[model samples]
Each structure stands twice: as C-alpha cells, then as structure tokens.
Target: MDFVHRKLEPPDLQDCAPQGTKVTDTDPRMIYHGEMIPVGTPDVAQGLKDARRALRTNRFRPTGRRKSMIIDGCAGKTTLLLQIGRAYQGLLETERRPDSEWTPVVYINVPPRRESNLDWSLPFADFFGMDHTINIDKRTYRSTDMTEPVAHAMRESRTSLILIDGIDRIHDSELTTAFDYFDCLQDRLRVSVIYCGRGAIDIVNEGLHNRRRSDRPGASEQFRSSLPVMWIRPIPFQKGQEEGWRTVLQSYDDNLRLYNHQPGALLELDEELHERTRGYMDTLDQLICQTAQQAIEDETEAITKEALDDMRVGRNEPDDDWA
Candidate 1:
C-alpha cells in the first residue's frame, strides 16, 4: 500500500477571532481579547512538540517526572498553552468514542495565593466532572481531606496530562512548598505535567534541591534530572518576513474592522511600524489596533504615520525595567 504525502495549511485568522467583531476607541476588546494568531516560531513549535511527546509517552507508561516550559511574559506563553490544549482536545475528540471517559489533557491557571494546595485540586475535580468535599472534626483522627476525591476522580478519568499556567504567582515564601506540592501530585498521580511561567523554573529547581537536602533525601535529584526545560523566546517580524506581518494585520482587519484596510495597505506600513514597535507581537498588535481606532475616530480610512505617532504619544513610558 502506498500513502500520500500532504502538507497542512495554517488556520484562517478569521476563525481564530471572535465572530463579527467591531472596534472603537472606547472598546479595546478587539485588541485585548483572547483571539490569537499562532505565529509558530521555531521555539514555540518545538515546545508544543515536546509537550505532546511527554504526554503521549506517559499515557502508556507512567512517568513520575513533570515537564517545564519557561516562556517570558508577553511572548505568547498563554497562546502556546491554549494551542497545546486545543490540539490535545482535538485528538481526544477524534480518537475516543462518544461514551469514552478519557480526558487526555487538563489546563489550569494557578491562582494568586501563598497556599494553593486546595486551589490546585479544585480544577482537577472540576475537569473530571466530580464533586469534592472536605470533612473536619475536632478529634485528630477524624479529619478528612478534599483532595482525595479529586485525585480519585483524576485517576478514574484516565487523565494523562496537565498544563499549569501562572507558576510565578506563588508567593516568595511559599514557592518551595508549591513546587513540593506539585511534585507530590506528579508522584502520586503518575501523570505528565507541564508548567508555563516567566522566571520560576530556576527558583523551582533550587527549591527542589533544598527540599531534598533538608526534608526528602530523594526529592530534587529525580525531578531535576528527568524534567526538561523548554524556553520560548519572543517572535519578531524580521526582514523577508513581511508576508507574515501582512497576514497578521489582515487577520486583525478582517476580524476587528480595522480601517477596512487591505493586507497590501497594511504591508506598506510594516517597515515603519516594525521600526517603532521593534516587531514585538503584543506591541505591534496594540500599535496597529490603537492606530486604526484613532483613524476611525478621525473619519479617515487610511492609517498614516501621524496616526501611529499620535497613538503612541504618552504611551512611551516603560512598563517594566526588563525587556
């Protein structure tokens, strides 16, 4: 038997955006909403591949170690996580029968709290469509933990993987404890896990080492040795990649009603915008969306350099000291 080789195409940007959206100066949803274009930088592509591989491998054979993906803020870290979840869910939808009870992946945004042991397990219970309850008693032997049900539900559901976001939200004092909690979950559940965050990986490693030395003698070595760290760098539109930027802008215009501008028209200003925003995707999106909103307010169909400059005015202050 002969098999045909076929190439896959990128998804339509309109499909990625909200249905029939309109933008105004007062309404920034078009710019800030969850709509995302997968730029597919090499780093992001590899990160997704590694995550899928780990999940696939762990599903059949248990892997007690978790995976870590470190992506800096504003570099499309959330987008990467969403894409991974979507892809895994799509696979589940296709491969599993309608009545099957397997949940291949679960994505959770770690809450902003010092202690998140219960917060972490709640999402797991919710994802498994199970009820969780805690029972307490004054007697020392009668206390009941809520996470037991969540863990049982996860195992019953055949949950193979978990994607955690916002690992950086753990308070400094509780960071080590949080890592220990996650490590315990991995060991107990035997599920593949991936964490996305800014700068928590190094701290997590250090915390693991401290725990191994002071508390659990075998804690850090296994985790630190087996877990692989993947970094996703910022994607910038470089020279010869004008077409990529054009597709992105065209997607924005088609979805957000920005200036009713054609892709070619947007491409004409690419160089100027690139120079201004340094091709940072978030900044570029903000610049174009805000500039187009300004142009619309001025009753103009075209976005000029003046509009770009005016939109950027008073917004030049650095939001952070780090790039």
Candidate 2:
C-alpha cells in the first residue's frame, strides 16, 4: 500500500462563539479544545524560523547537517515540533504537485523500550506503511531491519526533513545505535533532521562524538565546533520578560470562542495567568482551553478570575505552589 502522509490540519473553527458551533449532539467546539492551538510565542516562532532555515539550506545538499531543539522544561516540546513541521509543510504546499505522493517531512516519536535492543527502523516503516516484521510463530513476530528499504522509500517520496521527538525516552545504552541509525539515514537520504526533547543536547553530542570528518583539505577548519541547537524555555513573567507571556495569553484570548468575553480579557490577567502557569506553555494551554470549554458549558461566555482559579489542569509538582 502506498502511504501518503496527511498534513496536520488545524481545526476549522468558527468565529469565537463555540457554543453556536453545531456538528452533532456534542458541541463541535470540543474538537477545537482537543487540539493544541498553535500560538506564535516568541520561542516557538524563533524555533520555527531556525528549523525552516535548516530545512531550506539542506533541501538540495548532498549531506544534511543535524539540528537540535532543546526544551528547558518538558512542557511543550512536542507541540513546538508539530508547529515547526506543519509550518514547513505549508511552505512546500505551493511547490508540491497536486497529485504528488511526495512526503517532504517525517515525524517519529521514539518509543520507550524495556530492553536495550530497539528496531529504530520500525518507526519509519510504520510511517510509510511498509512491512518490517517477520513472523516468528503463529502468534509471535520479530521486527526485521528495514533501514535500507526505509531510506529508499524516503528518497522516492522526496522526503527532505525528519523530526525525531521523545529522544529522552531512549535508554542510555541504546543511544549509540539509535543515533547511528539517524546518521546513516542522513548520510544516505541527505535529509535535514531536527532532534527534539529535553535530552536532545546530549543526544546530539553523543552522535557528533564519532561523526566522520570530511577528508577534503581545509574541511576540519570549516567544520563547526558545535551542532546547531535551539532552546525552547518558558517565557518569564518578569517586567521586561512579561511581554512574551502576555503575547501568548493574548493569542489564546484572540482564538477563544467565548461569546461574552471582552477584548483583552486574558491580557488583563496576564500576571495571574503567569502566576498560575509559571509561564509554562503546556500548563497555560491546558488552563485556558479547559476554562474556555467550561465557560461555554456554563453559559458564562466569559473567562473570569474565579473560573481561572477554579480550573485544575496540568501536573502538580512537589515544588509547585501555583494553586
């Protein structure tokens, strides 16, 4: 079967009044709430730009350099990764043929392994709908190495970018083999790769440790001392730093579908929102999305301080005092 990667589509939301959106007996607004509304927060926007630049530069290169994006806290790395992927895909939509099966990008979440052995190629095979498993018995199976076929499929599909997420979940013992597979993929496919996770820096460092240096004269001098890295840290709520936080809140406000919500409602409570979410995008997203959904159900049609305070979402760390 030919696997055509579907582009990540944002929900087609109606203007602000989610209560009025009728898809079935259930409110269609629930679908919107289920998605992570892409906000162009400062860090996210910068990350997107860097990722795009890397992909564009490596589009026609014989070998692509690896890039890494590290998140200081584990709040929203996956969301940022998706945003970057979606943005890059959007850029290619104009150039992609109408009937083309060309999947310019591939996304994989590194699965947590119980043992040191992992079939790194399985993810790619799964993405492209290739059979990478061999039947061991009537009820048992083993994954066959699909690296070569996977690489060929990627090249055939004209895939230029690969996004690897959840690298932190990979066991330390498996890091060498995991990155080795990636290095092979990049060398063979000549595709731009963005490694993302909290431990992304370490992963990149390990991969670069034994990387083959070009034998061309002056190549060592031309090589970068460090891999390209982007950090996605939380927006601070301090005086000067507060603007980014406010901007993010304002984005949620703009996208919210509350009928009675006044303009700048969320912006006015930026400080409180920051205090509640500690400027963490994940927590902030959960808080706002849940609150908006609640307001809709309650017919309040507005986000209030009490409603915000009452909403409980996100993990509660021991040091967390945001309650």
The most accurate candidate by TM-score is 2
Count of clashes in candidate 1: 0
TM-score, each model? 0.67, 0.81
- Shift of residue 115 alpha carbon in model 1, Å: 3.1
lDDT of 2 by residue, 1-323 (tens): 12223432434445434554434324656556555456777877887788778767666555435443443235677767877777777778777653456788888888654232247878888888888777876789877777788888899888877888877676656666777777788777777777787756654565557432222234332443366666677788896677788788877887776667899999989877877777788888888878877776777868898898788875443247654
Cα displacement (angstroms), candidate 1, residue 114, comes to: 3.6
Model 1 agreement with the true structure over 1-323: per-residue lDDT tens digits = 00011222333445543434444534443343233333555566777787678656656674445444444444567767767766666666677663445555677777654365665566665556555554457434322234787676667766666777876665556766677777787787776666777654545565556432234334322545335666655445777756655666555544444434454666667666666666466676677666655555555645676677666523242232335
Once superposed on the true structure, which residue ranges of model 1 sit more than 4 Å away at CA?
Answer: 1-42, 62-74, 98-102, 123-145, 211-226, 237-260, 293-299, 312-323
For model 2, the stretches where C-alpha displacement exceeds 4 angstroms are: 1-25, 62-73, 98-100, 114-118, 210-225, 315-323
Give me the displacement of residue 249 in model 1, in angstroms.
5.2
